[model samples]
Target: MYVYDEYDQRIIEDRVKQYRDQTRRYLAGELSEEEFRPLRLQNGLYVQRYAPMLRVCVPYGLMSSRQLRKMAHIARQYDKGYAHISTRQNVQFNWPALEEVPDILAELAEVQMHAIQTSGNCIRNVTTDQFAGVAPDEVIDPRPWCEIVRQWATFHPEFAYLPRKFKIAINGAQSDRAAIEVHDIGLEPVQNAAGELGFRVLVGGGLGRTPIVGAFINEYLPWQHLLTYLEAILRVYNRYGRRDNKYKARIKILVKALTPAVFAEKVNAEWAHLKDGPSTLTVDEVHRVADHFVDPAYQALQDQSALLAEQQAEHPGFARWMARNVNGHKKPGYAAVTLSLKATGYAPGDITDKQLDAVAELADRFSFGEVRSSHEQNLILADVEQTQLLALWNELRELGFATPNIGLLTDIICCPGGDFCSLANAKSIPVAEAIQRRFDDLDYLFDLGDIDLNISGCMNACGHHHVGHIGILGVDKKGEEFYQVSLGGSASRDASLGQILGPSFAQDDMPDVISKIINVFVEQRHADERFIDTFRRIGMAPFKERVYAANH
Candidate 1:
């Protein structure tokens, strides 16, 4: 919840003005398509298959109720009456008119939001755990560091155009909800024996045509050198990363070719020039940024466990939802809630304008006038009072937000595949919907337990399929769409890329394919084991056999 200072406000407003002129120039034919391509990309506008798509950055997935209302209004007025939340915790408007994009950007700027650096071959949004400050297992709140990095990277001239898009993630909690290892740069806070703070940095981890978990480039980078070290890493990538081939341009590919040790050495050598530079972090700056993320006011109250238990016992539906959607909180009388967006029939992550407005109202009514977008394609009420859980669930249920399937198989993570994105080889939304419908049984899903089912339209991995417990990727076979499935992947504390199960299957076979995989897990799982754990222990043989065998 970092408030925009006067300087921040001025920069955003100025960018809006600049983009407005660029859009105008392109439309008037003063700029050719080739000339306008990078300019539009730099501003987060993409000309998709059907219409222009606009990606608006939601920094670290945090949004005020006021800002949420602004988004809802923009969705209703300028584009289609809906918006999609991305796996990176950003928002996308799929049907915005090309001419009105600048108007959309202007509206976003008024709310201290923008599409800057959201697209293009530059640093994108810095994402983290949705429950960053409030998670009970947090070592330290990462929002400050995320904000610091965001400030440094936004409009940095040195890295305006890299070989490819760069992503950075930070995780402060014991659980790695941010999927840090899959990012170009992953920063994990650590403390030495003296309890002094620092970071454990991972580099060159990414998923596309090739998937690799990041290697530890720096075991312990001092907290004071955070910015300088990041700069060093980027400088090395900017200089040596491939620029000729877009497919091989990512930093991960460069890291793999040079080997991790050599890459680390390069980064270290680069850091030697930047060590103790003016951009180095200071205790005062850390405190200033962190103050914006401090705990909100709370009245003295006891835990409502007894009351919730009684409510759960009375209503089986509520009990099911409570078990799946509710999460632990640092505050005694409060809990974080995940409003599941993966209901049957709807595309995963799609929120209608009315639903967005309702969520804003609900956040103000229940959560402390703030809302969070989860990396799992769900909205979060991060600081809801335990006393109001029942009331909140009822309202959410009415709004089709309480699906009772968070962390379940039906709670899928998916991208707007061929339906919206021209880059997609196949349709992702329908595949996600098909699977959700096939597994609508709440009891069955709960029994399956915590399955991260992610689907990507293509290898770009926008859906983060590489890290899902069950990852589905869409591919084209002679102009026809086929789906490839993977297993044993996780995006949490034990980050690992999923292994491909077997040959790709037709779109219609996806549901049955997924079902067979689940059946194998059910038959082989030990007591209290999740789908991912069972896969890890048993390997991919069982899943492959079950999915591809002649008959069950």
Candidate 2:
């Protein structure tokens, strides 16, 4: 919830005007498609399969109710009546007219938002946990550091056009909800034995054609040198990262080619020049950035477990939702709630303008006028009072937001495949819908327990298929759509890429294939074992055998 200063506001306004002119020239035929490609990409406009898609940045996934309302307005006025939340916590309008994108950005700027750095081969949006400040087990609030990094990365002259797109993630909580292991740079805040704060830095982590769990480069990088160290890493990558081939241009490939030790050595050598330079963070500046995220006025209250238990007894449906959607809060009587966007038959992350407006109202009523977007393509109200849980649940249920499937099989994380993305080999939305229909029984999904089923249209891995407990990727063979399955991948603290399960299957067989995988998991699992735990305990052999036995 960082508010823009006068200077920030001016920069956004100026960029909007520049883009407006750029758009006018492009539409008037003064600029060809070749000439306009980079310019349009820098502003988050992509010419997709059917139309132009505009990706609007939601930095660190934070948005005010006012900002949410403006986004709803843009969706209603400028494009289709809906928008899709991406895996990086950004929002995408898949049907924006090429000429009208500037107007959409101009509207966004009025609410202190923009599409800057949402796309192209530059440092994209800095992301973190959806429950950054409010998580009960947090070691530090990451939003301040994320904002500091965002400011430093925005339009940094040297990194404006890297060898490839770059992503960074920061996690300050005990758990790794931010998926730090799968980003170009992952920072975890930690305190030393001497009681000084610093970060555990990981580098060379990414997911694409070549998926990797990042390697640890520094055990404890001091707090003051965060930006300086980052600059050092970028300097090394920009100098040595491949430009000949886009596939191998990412820092991960460079790190692999040089080995992590040599990569660290290069970064260390580069850091020697800039460690104490002007880019180093100061205590006052840190406080200045942090001031924007000051805690809300919270009333003192005892725990509401007894009252919640009574409500659970009164309403079974509410009880199921409470179990799935509600999370423990740092405050005594407050909780964080996830509003499920995966209503059956709809796209996993698609939200209509009407639902957006309703969510804005709900945020104001229960969460201090702020809302959060999660990497799992769900919306979060991070500071709802526990006493008002029943009322909030009732309202969300009426809005079709209470599906009680936060981490279950039905709560799928999928990308808009061939439907919107030109890069996709097959349509992911229909695949997700088919799976949802197959597993519609709430009892069945809850029985499956804490499964992350991610589907990506192609190997770009927009849906993060590499890290799902059950990962599904679409493939094109002989110009026909087919699905590939993988198992045991995770994006948590113990991160690992999934292992593929033999050959691809026809699209029509996807539902039964998933059911077969689940059947194997159920047969082999120990008591109370989650899908991931069972998969890990008993490798991929059993699941692979069961999945491909008849076909072979």
Candidate 3:
């Protein structure tokens, strides 16, 4: 993980002090709710349905054991004793008192963390693959670039108040685990024919009331031109993005109205002047950032673990856990393990303070004192030794974090819908819970095989419903809650938005609808084909036909 430099430290401390003063003024009636709104939002505080929620950034989803422990402390002392991991790989506390948020941020500052840019109509947290440095297929680690962008975007005067919230994601692996296609800006590091490093830049992609995959803006931007090229994109958005209507303010809308080609042309015209500016990244600065993320010191060991193999043979539950939770690591004897938060009857990404502390301790004991939050809202210890797998599992089991459903049906991705979010047309968490209850059998989930069931409260797609194999979107029909279904959406390298099935269903009918869709996939799929592959091969007609047959 990258350590904060003096500049980084100074800026965060200043921001914290600024927010603390702003908070005091708001409490003293010097600032009204409307006046304090933007200030609080800039600090990542949101007034929710029941209470205020604070989202803390976990830069590029990397946290030290020490940082994790601090977060656990914050959760315990300031807010409710639990935190929800968001789809953007940030941790959100749902019960923070509005008055105590400044104090919480001050504490976070001590650990080189904060909630800045986690919300508001500005550039939000920059996300990348959680397995950045460790992935086998990576051409180069993307964390350095992510950090660079983080610094540039933080409190950027030009982009501080954009037309709407903008998100940027970077991916370095062959797989699109970061969901680059659905971000305002997506950067994929690519090597040219001559083996020089660069990025494939995509723009105008987003998921919301309107979902659009990003279009290719630049095929290859050299390493040195990253900042310049990014500035160009933001400049274009800031100048022409709609300001009249909140609903039409996103850059995606501008891109759609103008067409991607004209959008690129506008950005190119802006880049003509700023291409060689001082902010452009240089080799030395790149090295300075990259050096912070060098691999942890790894001990040499045998290629395979005899004890693990023996244990797997003895215990089926442990065997199943190892199959789903453990990932291949670049190191010989180490594995990356996911501590699933999707246990039955619980919210998908909710982890209590005690569980967070336990995970921090476990990371220090078995891994390299590092923890990662996945985009799927799971916790990962990236360097656990093969020999320690069973012991770690035991500890995690005690903490209620050892659910072996990483890619299973029960491992759902859901947004904090009507229960918390003011924008939601209906509640999504209850719907997710209902579906999980209907399909609680682990064997059945495993047999279903790598199904992605995502639910969003509305079209904002915070839950990533568009890319789910079975996407569920909440809709409003004459002020009543309803759900619309989509099939075959995927967020991998061959990314595609899902197709709608038909008429929306009432909230009570969601589980049955989902079950019917799954049954059709089970019945229609050829042997050895995944749900996505099956959907692609046969199209959505069969599932759509089956779902609305009675209505038709």
Candidate 4:
């Protein structure tokens, strides 16, 4: 993890002091609620349904064990002893007191962390692949670029107040784990035919009321020109992005209105001026940033064949977990473990203080004192030894974080819906829980295979329901809760927005409806095909026909 320098420290301290003063003025009656709104939001403090929610940024989803422990401490001391891992790979505390947020920011500053840019219409946290440096298929680590962009975008004067929130994601791996295609700006680190480092830039992709996959703006932008290119893109968006209506204010709207070609043309025109600007990255600076993300020292160990065979023989659950939750790592003996938060009864991304501490301890003990937060809202121990797999699973199981449901039907991605979010039409957590309960069988879920079940309380797509293989959107029908289903959505390399199934189903009918959808896929899929592949092959007609056939 990158250590904060004096400049970084000073900036956060100053921001904290400023927010503290702002809070005091609001409390003293000098600032009205309306007047104080943007000030608090800029600091990542939100007045939620019952209390204030503080979203703390975990830069590029990387955190030290000590930082994770501090987060656990914060959850214990201030909030409800738990934090919700957001879809953007940030940690959100739902019960932080509004007055104490500045204090919280100060504490976060101590750990080189802050809530800055976690919210507001400005550029938000820059996300990259969770397994950025460690992924086997990576051409270049994306964290350095993510960090560079993070600093550049933070409190940027030109874009401090955009018409809507801007998100940028970078992916360096062969697999698009960062969901780059759905971001306002997406960068995929690539190597040219000559083997030079560069990025494949994509723009105008976003998910919300109007979901659109980003289109390629540049096939190859040399790594040195990253910041310049980014500035150019932002300049175009700032100038022309919609401001009259919040719903259409995002860069995606602008991209849609202008088309990618015109958008790219405008960006290129802007870039001509910025091509050699101060913000243009230098080779030395890139290496300096990249140094912080270098692979940790690992012991020289061969593959643990005996240990794997033992795990397969002794523990079926561990075997299943290894199959679903473990990812290939760059190192020989190391594996990236996804500690699934989607247990049968728990909220999708909720982790208690105890669980957080356990994860921190596990990272320190088994991994390299580093942890990652996946965009799927799961905690990752990125460098665990294969020999310790069963033991790790046991510890995680005791803490309710060992669900063997990654990428399965039961592995649901959900938002803080009506239960906590004021914008939600219905509670999404309960819906996720209901569905999980309906599909608790491990064998059955494995049979269903690589299904992405995502739910959003509203059209904001906070839960990324638009890209789930089975997307569920909560709707209000005649003042009653209902769910609208979509199929064929995926957030991988072959990104595609889901198409909605027919009429919405009532809350009570949701579980059966989901089951029917799954059954249709199972009935129609070719041998060994995943839900997404099957849906793409057959389209939504088969699933839609089966799901709504009885009603029609």
List RMSD in Å for every model shown: 1.1, 0.7, 1.4, 1.1
Query: TM-score of the candidate numbered 1?
Result: 0.99
lDDT digits (tens) for residues 466-523 of candidate 4: 9999999999998898999988899999699999988988888999999998888888
Better of 2 and 4 by lDDT: 2
User: Which tens-of-lDDT digit does each residue in 1-552 have in candidate 1?
Assistant: 899999999999988898889889988999999999999998899989899999999999999999999999999998779999998899999998989988999899888999998899999999999999999999989999999999999999999999999999999988888888889999999998899999999998998888889888888889999999999999999999999999999999999999999999999999999999999999999999999988888767789999999999998999988998999899899999999988899999999999999999998888889999988989999998899999998998899999999988988999899999999999999999889888988778888888899999999999889999999999999999999998888888768899889889999998898888888999999997998889889998878877778654
Question: Best-fitting candidate, measured by TM-score?
Answer: 2
Model 1 global lDDT (CA atoms, 0 to 1): 0.92
User: Model 3, 58: alpha-carbon shift in Å?
Assistant: 1.1
Question: Using Cα atoms with residue i matched to residue i, what is each candidate's TM-score against the true structure?
Answer: 0.99, 0.99, 0.97, 0.98
Kindly list the per-residue Cα lDDT of model 2 for residues 186-205, writing each as its tens digit: 99998899999999999999
Q: Comparing candidate 2 with candidate 3, which one achieves the higher lDDT?
A: 2
Residue pairs with backbone overlap in model 4: none
Where model 3 places Cα greater than 4 Å from the true spot, the runs are 305-307, 550-552
Stretches of candidate 2 exceeding 4 Å from the true structure: none
Candidate 3 has an lDDT of: 0.89
Question: All candidates' lDDT scores?
Answer: 0.92, 0.94, 0.89, 0.90
Question: Which candidate's lDDT is highest?
Answer: 2
Residue-level lDDT for 363 in candidate 4: 91
